[model samples]
Target: MSIWWSLHLRRDAASVPLARRFLLGAMETAGVDPEISFDLSVALSEACANAVEHGGDRRVQREQSVGRDPWDVWDEPAGTACGQYRVTAYLDGEKCRIEVADSGPGFPARRMLRTSAQQHDPQLYPSLSAEDGRGLCLIEQLADHVHFGNRPGRGALVSFDKVLKWRKGALLMVS
Candidate 1:
């Protein structure tokens, strides 16, 4: 049986590379198929990228000290993503859950979904194209569960989960 791995990572754009490495490691250790690994990588990359981009404008400082891998810049303390934008990764069997949190203003999930449809619907006018807003759509397609909510006065948390393979298109079981 594949083992479940729980890891906490500091929230920073530089930490994204580390997240990918960790996921890839878990995938390899679990003997996950190449195709599935590819999917996991892509999904994880997008999630981590979102964390980094949303972490902060000038506040997203990446440390390059002590032989920086150039991939993971090491954000130091958690929650202090400039003030504590933590990222947590959970891997169990063929299931994976990733959460990215930041101490900033939250977004409206409904509006985000609606805008995504309007942008990627293809039927929409070309003049209404949105360069952004596609991340959540892509994420929803990749993950079985996509949740967004406010962290009170902190900021927001985006949670996503995926099952590697099994019955295709299977819904994410809550229990």
Candidate 2:
């Protein structure tokens, strides 16, 4: 069976763990290996954190473009705010896919170039002392496949997927 869920989370720090917890619960229920789940959760947190920190800029830009007060979005309902991000997960027969999308300026062209190079050799682009610039690398290392890009006029998108390794007697085991 294929199971999937999507969340529209506020651009707040708390949403990071909330997304992770939901992912963990889904993985546990599907009988995914704990180690794999942990890896994915960490990667998810990094992506969510980036969104929480940067996603607001795009909302402000969009609001300005449409002649609305940038702060007006804040008055909307919790999840309905323009300053929000999306997290989606899919657990299929043999793999799980996770995506985090946000309303931000998106990655710069140079960053994508660096990301491609890092994917080939992450060691070549280590940020030992820096606070940021490690999230995409971490996600690349944890996931079997990762795609980073933008959604046209929307914003940044980070999509990653891993081949599911089942625990003993997994509910959705493909055996």
Candidate 3:
């Protein structure tokens, strides 16, 4: 069986947990192993937090300057003027994929370089003391596959997937 869900959420702190909870509930209901579910949930939280905290304001300003309605471009509900982020998840067999996209300035090129450097030479790069920068690292460690990109003229996209392992006997019940 395959399951998928998408959430269009306001760029607010509260929305982060909402997204995480939805994912956790979905995984629990589907009998996804707790360990796999926990890892995905934490990664999802990081992604959502990045979107809410960093994705919206600059994009909104750019859209307004061009006389285009920002929310309209994203197809957000009418009357919702705030910036929005989207989270999507797909589960098929033992693989689960999740994407978090934001309408902010895309991931900085330098940060990507830094991440690469840190991965290759942790002693040289060390950990960033800045409030930001840890989320991508956490996501990289937790997900089996990770991809980063931009959304055309708009925002940043972070996608990650994990190959799940079922609890003993759970696979039989699912089949």
Considering every candidate listed, which one attains the maximal TM-score? 2
Scored by lDDT, model 3 comes in at: 0.78
TM-score for all models, in order of appearance: 0.62, 0.82, 0.80
What lDDT tens digits, residue by residue, belong to model 1 across residues 28-84?
665555566667677777766665666542343345234544333223322234433
The global C-alpha lDDT for each of the candidates, from Candidate 1 onward, is: 0.58, 0.80, 0.78
In model 3, which regions exceed 4 Å deviation? 59-82, 111-120, 123-128, 168-175
C-alpha lDDT (0 to 100) for residue 119 of candidate 1: 43
Give candidate 1 regions above 4 Å deviation.
1-11, 56-84, 112-129, 166-175
Q: RMSD to native for every prediction?
A: 7.7, 5.0, 4.5
- lDDT measured at residue 126 in model 1 versus the true structure, 0 to 100: 30
Q: Give the RMSD in angstroms, all C-alphas superposed, for model 3.
A: 4.5
Evaluate model 2: give its lDDT: 0.80
lDDT of 3 by residue, 120-154 (tens): 56653436676667787788889988888876557
Task: Report the error of model 3 at residue 95, Å.
Answer: 0.4
87-174: candidate 2 lDDT, tens digit per residue: 9999999999999887677777756533554567746565688877787788888988888897655677899999989999998878
* Order of the predicted models by lDDT, top scorer first: 2, 3, 1
